[model samples]
Target: MFGLQACAKAPTAAADAAKPAAAAQDDGGYPLVTDVRLQNAGNDDGWLMYRRDYGSSGYAPFDTVNAGNVAQLKQAWDYTSEFDMGHEAPPVVNGDYMFITTPKNHLLAFQASTGKLLWKYEHDLSNAGLKTVCCDVVNRGVALYQDKVYMATLDNHVVALDAKTGKVAWNEKIHEQDVGYAMTLAPLVVKGKVIVGVSGGEYGARGYVTALDAATGKEAWKQHTIPMPDEPGGDTWPKGAAETGGGAAWLTGSYDAETDTLFWGVGNPGPWLATLRPGDNLYTDSVIAMDPATGKIKWHYQYTPNDTWDYDGTNETVFTDIDYKGAKHKAIVSASRNGWFYAIDRTDGKLIYAEKFATATSVTGPDANGKMQTDPALRPTVDKEVFTCPSFLGGKNWWPISVSPQTGLAYVPTLHSCMTIKGAEVSYKAGLPFLGESFLVKRDPAFPNQWGSVQAIDVNTGKQAWTFPSELPWNSGMLSTAGGLLFSGSADGYLYAFDAKTGKVLWKSPQMTSGVLGVPSTWKVGGKQYVGVWAGWGGASPIWGGEMAQDPKVKGIPLGGHLYVFSL
Candidate 1:
């Protein structure tokens, strides 16, 4: 009931993102993805959900095709979706079945080893949906439960489908699409509940996360990212400002079964002009740890208080134990969009160590109490334009970071750019963009001319170990393996396999049809390990990236929706 409170327009949404199944080959049996099985999925040879496990590490345990044989990798199979827009999903596989989602909520199932299309679910979106999504129409991936495949659509829908037939099972509306609310992150299925987060903060929509009953599609629990008047942290926002204060929980969160905690990242505050709402803005740019069953918030940590540069803290939280100050502590690490990397004590929400991984000038540093201290002179105002680092697209964004148990390092796809931002006067209208600011992405002369790179951070010390720079913004998600190999794609259309310990590129795939915006995943079928990634040139960097998008090297990248699988 704590949804949009702005008095402007009516809003509503649908339940499902599927329909009549488009048959391909014979549909296979459903892959049983139980809560227990998913609990140990990080050690499994399959990918059951987004980022493969509750850790949300974007890593797999397969080692058959690794650094030793990566150079011999050859195309094993390939498939293309009918629709093309930012193809952000990882090639998710369970048993011998592979599931992938394309833009506009299309989910396709295939015979894992042979690339034979099994069944396709083409979701039809209303024309009104075009006005909802703030970024490209992208679906990260699908969730595989016992007998169902789950997807959260861009039209603010939570849908369940028959895993074997791609037939619609149940569909439930999360919010009114017209209210500027949409769901792009893949549904996280935990203990019979389908959890999803809302986006569209730019449109002034209040953000929240909902958990639908996996069997019936009924909402079990819901929690708004922005605190209410009587709720905890409500004092952070003044008067009625909390109603439209955007703390969009835009990314799928990491789960810790050991403590029964769900660590979700809250995005930026709305109306970009921070002075308009005042206070630390509560949970806006922070991570909230909650109970998975009842949606009760336990502890929260803020990354950038009163964020005005659009530096959303909605990055995947990777769980790992880090050694700091001569002691080993369990932590959750996030490479925040505000240009800082943080490792917080997962148990108590205390800062263990905070480090700068990119060129940043917006903040002075973290204070004794761990609050991020900003450069007051750099605050963007209507009369004063200020230049900042790590542009709004982030030092790193929702592309996801993978932590490797083998390397004891987190592999991050880093974007290096800055912005010149200025505040503007704006008012909220139902389903309309609410950002009260103007900005342009640009290069920072203080850093190298490179726009992106893949940096490996030493978890123990919270220091960057090595960097693999790119000519273009590295938008692809990173995937690490037990074989001591790290895999990631390029905006130039090649997939490279690097030695996880060193930053040496051991193997690079031939150029594909377009730049890569998809995350890479690996799984085993019939005892053979295979690597897969989607080739498509579309994402926020090219859309919101102003002058940077017009760079000579970035101008000609083609659009596509091809899923390519490789094997040694």
Candidate 2:
């Protein structure tokens, strides 16, 4: 029933007829989001992009919903999209309008102050092979630039829509859906270009990042994550395996205005087994910095070279200025999937610090160069089974972390699971799963009942300030506010408010339908502060790590498709 209508135009007349006169108050005029607006996005007015701003701090400066008054918050409004797949997109707010995307690539615009539907645009992917998608049919969100909204579809198409009217302006096919390429990340609008990345590392597709003209949808530049034989990191990969190397830039990247650099994390190499593709696998499990204008790699740092445990480096590279080694440094930090937290100098890609944040059994620690001190015995072979910590679900997945400059701490949502892996013989096939390993994911033996945690790490010292444990793995991302509160949702259907200084749960409310898989966002409208998040329980964990999903802690969570908002 969801896909029955190919392109259902929003009934504008009916929506206008239902609007209440009292809800039509003009706080300000809707203006085009320019470079200036993006740089100042953290100001108390609106949440402009996926992680609030180009820095990906995920922190809001609004204090209306501070620690003292957050307990008095109540649901202001609720809206259900009724499509019922994973609702992972964070709502983007600009002036009085808010935009959000649902599963299957349905973009909806609504009045920010009042829950009035402005317009809706649903992309039709019925003819595309839905089964080819490695994960569930999920979308992260949309980007707003000059009067247009940009969203990447599940079928590997980047479409630009007129922001005011929900009309398609241009649609460009970035990758072939038949060959296991899809785009689920929200496009990042940098200067005049819309940047996006492809998905499907599990199916052996070569990954790439492309930039397109924001106005005409014409490709401006493209950068392949996997390099050829003569490329810089080519020697790290086997002779010809670089052709299908799996360094997927599947998540949205962050930008540094001062350096004119774009930071993106790459995913794991092909075939979950390590022996099949020998060597460090080049840049697969690495973070790459590039020049946005030329799409040329500036520098790269590999986190888990020749990663065999399926540890993807596609986590957010949060940019912040920290006091490291008793001196102030411009740093980019990440709570990596390999169960370690790393801090690097963004200007030169030099390692500042690296430490384990979760139960990592495969890695002992970081060496002088910050590369993991890997245990050779932990590598699984075709003839032997090996148990490794921080399972394929990762110590942390694509869910975002919030960094509060006010508190000088990074709030990380983490998974505390492990896996037993055994290699199997397999051959490469395009459009088919190239993973040559069998794995059973489970919670760590020491803490079999606990599966998730929210860790507050002091970015400067690379030390965890405090940790808040969860019974189930966190499906939601994080939001930090000037009120000294950290907001995050969970697989148990509750959106929690925590004290930023201490790991104390101040308040929480049940979402009532399903787990919260989306990130939380904050914005101010009509002088009132509001917090919002999408309630839906679907993502890679449920699809790839089926055993972990069926664990007693998370088994009762149901599917959902509703947007929950609260205010004082």
Candidate 3:
């Protein structure tokens, strides 16, 4: 845990002076959000990545439309992704152009103001990729650096495309799909290097993040999440299983340029069942800060050690400066899938404090070291169903969380459900990967109303500031603005606006879509600011096929595949 004296310092670097930063050419325009600091993964211009910024705050401080007349917001334009598994691409906006991808891997370049199609690139990934993907087929989005766009396909290839023309500049293979590896996360570009991580935590693949020369597509660095035998953190896992230990950094990570540290949140261990691999899984289910220059780990803080609940720590790591206990502190905050909101000292990767943000009945509290209080009773077992709060699905899934330095509040989209998990364990064999079976059980009486909640917490106090209730899961990422409003979407097809100070529902509109799982982004084009979000459903909710499928209320609403933009 981060002690009282462990205050973080901003990584060294002057603010981008209207030029793209890093290894790419300085575009002489607004800097790119190469790291994880902005919502839409960059600045407020157009969302370049999943978080809109490297901090993964999901918050945009721009406010052309404010509380005074947010109800007047009207549809600016709409773009249909044309493939309907799940529209998760966050649009990357530069000047008047916006580029986005669909769940089926269709990349489209559009006029940001009118949604006029510039060009589209559809990738025909091999059918072999279908088998490698554990869940539904989907792409998170793409990254923009220099004059090119970078994206990883489900077929396990990283392709660089010219930004002005949707043409492939260069394509390279980071991993092959044959060994049960699929690349779905967005590629991150920093300095002159493009960094990407492999997915398939559920498929028992050796996870690693590879850095490539952005210009030549040459290998720069590769940091394996799972350690080799005799290497550091190697003794934690069973002999040869380290390769399949599953500490995938599948989601987008944040970067502190001043410290030269890249912060990545790792996923859960493989095979789900804890009895297979023993010892505290070092890098898995933890946040590791690495040097972007050499990919060397600087510091790490584990959220769940030897996790059995399938609680991956692969959510967004939001970086911000907060006034804590009358002292200014550089902090990294994350709303973890493990049902806890953690604030840590980013500079040294120290756990500052953690608070339960949702119904987490598995553990009582953190131990003296600030690690999660592991409950032996909640550990998975064969044929014996143990009810666990926050389920494997978690108190919070991958929907992005937002932090407003203006309001001093962190907004989180949360779930309040639980599941009964029975772990049927088996031995791990090469090529066979891992064998474990688990199913969901819903027993709580308050399961329906408790399904979703949007909470605003005071970062300084580590307490709830306000909350907005939801009839469905809070499955969408949040966006906050200087206009004193918070914007978030729902699986129920409603896009909502709430007061930043009070959790008052100021306005609501039916984006007319189900299961909106992507991060919403906003930007100004033609001097008129507009808010945008991809409204198509699909993600982990289908895998369980439990409450969301059987719930008598929401079963009728079909999935969606469209993009919605709004303006006043």
For each candidate in the order shown, give its overall lDDT on alpha carbons.
0.84, 0.84, 0.75
Model 1 C-alpha lDDT per residue in residues 317-337, reported as the tens digit of each score: 999887787898889998989
List clashing residue pairs in candidate 2: none
**Residue-level lDDT tens digits of model 3 in 189-306:** 7777888888877778778888899888989998988888788888888887787887878888887777778988888898788887888877898888898888887778888888
Candidate 2, residue 411: CA error in Å?
0.5
> Which residue runs does candidate 3 get wrong by more than 4 Å?
1-44, 429-435, 441-448
Where model 1 places Cα greater than 4 Å from the true spot, the runs are: 1-29
Give the TM-scores of the predictions, in the order they appear. 0.94, 0.94, 0.91
Instruction: Name model 2 segments beyond 4 Å from true.
Output: 1-29
- Cα deviation in Å at residue 64, candidate 1? 0.7
Kindly provide the TM-score of model 3 when superposed on the true structure, using C-alpha atoms. Answer: 0.91
Residue 147 alpha-carbon offset, candidate 2, angstroms: 0.5
